[model samples]
Target chain A: MTSKQQDKDIHQYDIHQKKGFSSEEINAMSQSVLNEKLDNIDAVTLSRLHQARQQAVDAAVLRPSFLQRYWPDRCNLSRSDHPILQPLVLVGLIIFALGTGYLMSHTRTDQLNLGQGEYLANEDDLEVAEDLDFIAWLIEQDKVSDNHAG
Target chain B: MQAQQQRNHLDHFLARVERRAFHLAQLATGQTQPALDIVQDAMLTLSKKYAHKSPSEWGPLFHRILQNKIKDWYRHQSLSQRIIDWFGKKSSVRDEPDDVIQTAVDRQTPLPFERLKNEDLRQALNMAIEKLPRRQQQAFLLRHWEGFSVKQTARVMQCSEGSVKTHVSRATQFLKQQLEGFYHDQ
Candidate 1:
């Protein structure tokens, strides 16, 4: 086909043309084509091609090396053998436990402190009375007279 | 037990498609490690986000995830950077044949190996497919190699069917030209 004809009629070419080329012909044709392309493509590109296939298979197999980043599995454990609650559920449980524990501890601490404060105040009352000076003594004597009248 | 069954189904599905997916990703990235990383990411993302989706939805859903990963990689690497990244850093100083002239060269010459075995031909075809522009390669692979319909290829490539047609056309033309020498020799 002429260049213009090739350009214009290119659309008529079937993407999946499996008609004329035998397996052997296809092989021979592709080899030449590949060799030409490879002449242009470098070794690094070849390496990338190798990695892409390996990686795809690795991911499909769910290898630990591929899964460890997103999964909660211990690096050394087999995923199938060491069954644990799903990571999300584990996180939820931990949060619930921490919240309840904090609330219970906080309430208990508040109660203990209140009891200690009351005990300290009672102990200070006797000391205050014994240490009272003239103003405190007169105030106490007046409080005693008022109690007698009542 | 039900979860286990679901997991089994997913494993089966992935096993069946793994090689093709790997090959597709390899073609896109033109190397293995990044392709592997992208494929791995796509698999995890698909399982996490779409495993609960219907079984029939898996192919397109997995492909969409893969497409997004490819785009993310491309976004990080500029066009020139992509060439360097795919080719190599040290190779930057080496002059490349102008792509336009190379395209002409690719059109006129027979590929070097006209007598390679069938397996080699398939490998060669796969390599040539890889060297194609990203969209054209995807279009060609999805439509011809994978046997997806144009509409399906369009959906996978996230473009209109018309765009798919254009990509396929260009890809076929390039491939034919690239394969012409072998054909003539045969």
Candidate 2:
């Protein structure tokens, strides 16, 4: 039978088509036509789709880099597919990171200064500790003298 | 080893769905290139993120990604882009023939003359589909073309079940009206 007759046969089998307002497709005619369209996909396009699937599969198998993994938008280049915005975003992130690092280093320097201030505040205790050591030396000298005298 | 198995499973799934996905995108966009890009984008997304999900989950996820990409395309087209695509369509449809006869490889595949009758049906149906409103087209294609159940279509469309049913019913009525001649001619 011709494809038309075949399609008619398909329609005949579909009771849904008789309903005239079937929720489903007009039986399999359209779906089969669409499927035929798929079969007719040109080689170049088919190859391209195959290549796309390959690329996708490669992407699936080969792990994404840290950048692709964490920052997906950065990888897309299609925030509306501008592509120009990707570089801008990268530049923004770099500047932000540098600024954050600079601020962090400044805070660390301040903390170091605060630590030094605490040490300076303990200078009086250091002097007391030195005096205790000197007293200990004096006691030792006296004890030595007494032993010598005996 | 298990990762290899997972990759194989993913490859298998993508291969099975790729052609139909391409057709779905092509019909939605009414342009081949963006449709390819959209399908590729969808594939990339599904593989990248959802490959780890249950294989069964991939269908809805892929369709969602594809639908979202189509919506994104609709949102982003500049008028210049549309004009360019209009001109591009003429040259490409001529120069790079993605036509049925040119693409058919099997021995049993019909010649252009023999296929002419059905070609009218295909073109008419395609044009009718192209004329449909975006939501109706999407609803009909997903409901029938993609063979999704109402519930599944709703989930993919991110709409209520009632909304999906309504959309499908309206789309059905519209398509039946549009293709009335083609059916009658047969």
By TM-score, the best candidate is 2
Candidate 2 per-residue C-alpha lDDT over B73-114 given as tens digits, one digit per residue, 9 for 90 to 100: 876765545677878853232144355643455655443432
lDDT values, one for every candidate:
0.62, 0.76
Model 1 Cα lDDT, one tens digit per residue, A12-85: 46432532334344434544543445444334444444454444433343223433444544444433356564
Using lDDT, give the best candidate's number.
Answer: 2
DockQ of 1: 0.07
Our model 2 lands, by Cα RMSD against the true structure, at: 13.0
**Maximum-DockQ candidate:** 2
Local distance difference test, candidate 1: 0.62
- Give the CA lDDT, 0 to 100, for residue A126 in model 1: 54
Colliding pairs, model 1: A32-B113, A48-B31, A48-B32, A49-B31, A49-B32, A51-B32, A52-B32, B110-B181
Angstrom error of the Cα, residue A110, model 2: value is 8.7
| Model 1's interface RMSD | 9.5
Give i-RMS (Å) per prediction: 9.5, 4.7
